[model samples]
Target chain A: MRLPSLIREVWANLLKKPATVKYPFEKLPLSKTYRGKHELMRDRCVGCGLCAKICPAFAITMRSVYGKVSPEVDLAKCIFCYQCEDVCPRGAIKRGKEYELASWSRNEMIVR
Target chain B: MEALRKAEENFVVLKAFNDLVLDVVSKDLCTKCGMCVSSCQVHAISMTDEGPKSVGPCRQCEACYYGCPRSPATSEELLKASLSSEKKDDILGSYNKIVSARTVLSEVKSVAQDGGVVTTLLIYALEEGLIDGGIVASKSTIEAWKPVPKVALSINDVLEAAGTKYSNCPSLVALKDALYGYDLSKVCVVGVPCQVTAARNVKVQPKAARKIGDKIAFIIGLFCMESFPHVKLAQFLTSNGIDIAKVSKFDIKEGKFRVYMGDAEVLSVPIRNLKDYANRFCETCRDLTSWYADVSVGAIGSGRDWSTVIVRSDEGAKLFDGAVQNGYLEVKDIESDGIESLRKIAKRKASKN
Candidate 1:
């Protein structure tokens, strides 16, 4: 309502650093607990298929990799809930902070 | 004697898995007892929710066909092999003694369905070196109240598997795991009547079941009127406004299907109303008392918190006496009225089915 208060507020905001970063150049730091891409530890996996069974989006499918059964996640369909990591009896599945998942081909969206 | 001769003649013709599919499975006479799957030496068969299916090439060994309970090729022979006795009753089958018994253990009684006799005997057998492991139906970790056949090796595992699951569980399928996976020389099997018949058939088949059957130390059969399909039973319970996961126990008593949650009755429906959910193949089953089992136990013809046990074989009588002498169980003679009621129910099931 007052012109002096408005001018003071604008001056203070001008002195403060910007809250955003440039696109594709400077990126914001991700939190340590951020959930993004899935990483499966092949050696630790027991092939129980519990992750595939508990996946609400049906994104995980069990496939034989290197003669041992493991989960292949379809990142395109994943909800990034980290439920697979939670339900795995062996701590095999982990969530990584790699949110830039845009790809030219759909086949690239799968995480083996 | 004539029927036994006929069964032998039938056994002379080797039947394969395809014959089982054609005669029992396709005709809806398969009890889903998992005998064929367990009897397959080559591991060609796997159990599905629909029934047993061939996952690998058939070896044509005829194990699956002859081992099936529905196949008439081995029924009479299996009965004679398991209970070679002269005295037999039309309703109760051949038994050494019929008694009313209850377990004295408080831990087992708290979680058991009726008298905890099954769990008590299993504990006794495991601790007494009679059996290294027992195959029982334990609750599934992923589903509520769904029975999954398991190999319980320890007393804790046996205690965890206590209580009755009113769903069709292919319990004999776990026999392979109990023998091979757990590497147990002596194992016990607990199952329903159809499963008992399957086990007996497995025991009598000399070629395929010789290794597996020899490891089976005892069989405990529970009286089953009929087992409900899991999906349909869950649907029925959900439709009745009961949360499936919250249910702690299920019981069929006094003509009612009761559901309980921690000492509180949550739902009660007439058993007749659940006819639609009963397994279609159960109606063709005639052995209500598991006539081929070593020991048969049921809630019928017994008071509250008690089980009516029928010791069918000499081994069964020995096991019963051992449990009683070890102070794990309390025994009393079943009343004549109790026997009459049990016979009436058994006859009704035999005639109605």
Candidate 2:
């Protein structure tokens, strides 16, 4: 291609609409595999504690009373690395895409 | 000057005008379902009639779709057949006959996770020289699922393992460790059905079969439908504004976890939400009672504060009988209706994938 034509194409491209999503303003559709927020179904939780054991970050904790299972996670310590979601054989702790996680204070970062 | 001005106009003005025109003409595909409205964690997303509109320019955060169940739903609900069968009287009698001869409830219930029957029984075995150590779930820290196969030497340790952990715990690997790593001659391990089966499969720890693996003197199985992922439980507590640090108690009853925040019933979370976090492995499981275990301990069809224990082997019956004889346990022959309920529950759970 000629240099003049290439430069013209480049200029035209620059003037065209950018492919970047406005993000929060213009949200991008999440990919099918995007891992984001963690959700727990209370009734189904048998408190077996496999999720915490497999978590490399050790961010999860199991709580209980009268022998029932209860678990908690600290989002501040989480790296958003979805290892916990993958090893969960029950698919209990799944990744959700709501990724806006900024906070004015350190406490806000603490999920649990 | 005019030529320079024209050149400047050519570079910036035309492009800016074109962008504005394109922006206005473009079709906004945002569906104003208010799904994003409820999904946003920071109130960042709002819906307008003219397609879901964004108010403040987004901070590039994508919290809207992550927690939304409708936006590319991550899970599927399917119909499946059950895998369990009724517990035969012969099987029950055999197990009771064995456990009742060997152990007591005082030792089991005092230190166990919930009712303490399992732990107490295990302790009696260890103390009575029936076994070396009781392999049970032991809490390493307050923040993680209790690791299974933790050998408890004292009554306190046994009590720690007595509770019901409805979440899928990998501590079942402790069985593998017991057979391979620890040179135990006889080990009393507690687990779910899968772990019991795995333990029974091992004949020798090494390839040469040089070291005979430990015999599972007692296999106390917990009844489980499915276990939740630990992270989901934690997130639910926090999202509901419950202080995790201050949480003193957590109970699952009537399909709800009545979370107590400093002695106050702050939240009653539906058990269905907790079910969403269950481990996927449970779907394929067919045995509600570890059929191979010496005895299974769970609350599937029992009244509160009592565990429905199904003794499967002779060894289990002996221990249970012994515990009762020694006045350490209180035994009420399970009613026929209760037994039927348990069987129904087991059959249903076994079939669900």
Candidate 3:
């Protein structure tokens, strides 16, 4: 209601940075502890299939990969709880910060 | 109408599912043998991991209460009805003959825990039309080393279910399904001592067992010192630095619990060390060899790769002799030393429990 005080408030607001960012064009940095996609170290995997056994979502399947059995994750069904990371005896499965996982086809969502 | 009212007033009050829960399940004496479930005429009882729970209204029929093996009212009568006084041994019960036997079949031997006598005898019984199916404890597909009661219809099914599971399996629960769901009129049941006692109780009980008891062709009992709770056993093994999934076989011999992965021995611990994992109900069990089973087969009092077979009933003797004569199993007399050891062990279990 005060003209000079209102003008000063407007000037201060104009100098402040916007709270929201353009997500697609200018993305914010992801936290270091973010859990998203899985990265399985094929050599470290013992072919035990413990990850598949402990997976509550039933997303991990044991499959023969390059002559050794390994876990193949279906990202479409996975809850990304990182249980595979926790239960891996050999430290084979790692959580990655790659959350942009939308795809046109379900088959493409699987991560071997 | 006056007579009917008088009769109704004089009706005797018999114990029902509630009494079973209060007397046995509540007291933690319930062995989870599935006898009560199968004994229920109205399908009121359902077997759970904890024990049998009432899923339907109780009709006060007293079938479940009387037919339960752990019931105090029926145990004495059941023993009197099922066991004979002709050749009763203090520890081994009444038996016509005892011998060390091994299966002649290579297929059975490959997978058998001991001499493959149970599998071979079941196969012979199946081929001879003695039984339409055999109730066995088969390994659960989803969980490694977990036993699930299964009705094996053929030799392959019997062989597939070979070997011993060191955990308690409520095998009698599958009796109703074997009699009705599989349409098996005559089925052989293989179980541990408590389960054998439950099966015998179901057969001897006057009222509730009439529906499913006659269908049981034979009962093959396994000698058990004690059985471990599956979850506790798994935790014990895991805590001992043994991977449950990688364990291919488990055995208790010379007072040591052994775990095997393929052909190699992975871990060994004294049986006393795993006492904490043993089912509490097993502490009350006195039978070392199934005293009431038609035939009891166990690894005790026998050489390597041989099973000690004790034939109790005439039917069991006929089956064992037939298996031997038909070249399904090879039999030899058990040594005096072996008998002495068996008696000693059985006596210890009886007195300790």
The candidate 1 chain A region of ten consecutive residues with least summed lDDT is A85-94
Residue B325, candidate 3: alpha-carbon lDDT: 97
lDDT of all the models against the reference?
0.84, 0.52, 0.84
Sort by TM-score, best first.
3, 1, 2
For residues B225-333, what per-residue lDDT tens digits would candidate 1 score against the true structure? Answer: 8899889889998898888889988998887999998889988888888988899998787778888889999999998988999998878877889999999999998
Please give the ranking of all candidate structures by lDDT, highest first, separated by commas. 3, 1, 2
Better of 2 and 3 by TM-score: 3
How well does candidate 3 reproduce the true complex, by DockQ?
A: 0.01
lDDT (Cα, 0-100) at B156 in candidate 3: 88
Candidate 1 TM-score versus the reference:
0.72
Compared with the true structure, what per-residue lDDT tens digits does model 3 show for residues B1-353? Answer: 99999888866456878989999999989999998877765577889899999998865656677677788876555565575536778689888888999999999988998899999999999999999999899999998888998889988889889999999988888886886578677989999988888777766665445446667888899999999988998898888888788999999888899999988998999988887889999999889999989999999999899999999987788888999999999999998788888889899899989
Assess chain B of each prediction and give its TM-score. Answer: 0.94, 0.63, 0.95
Which RMSD values do the candidates have, in order? 17.4, 26.8, 23.4
| Candidate 2, position B16, lDDT | 19
lDDT (0-100) at residue B254 of candidate 2? Answer: 58
lDDT of 1 at B38: 75
DockQ of each: 0.01, 0.01, 0.01
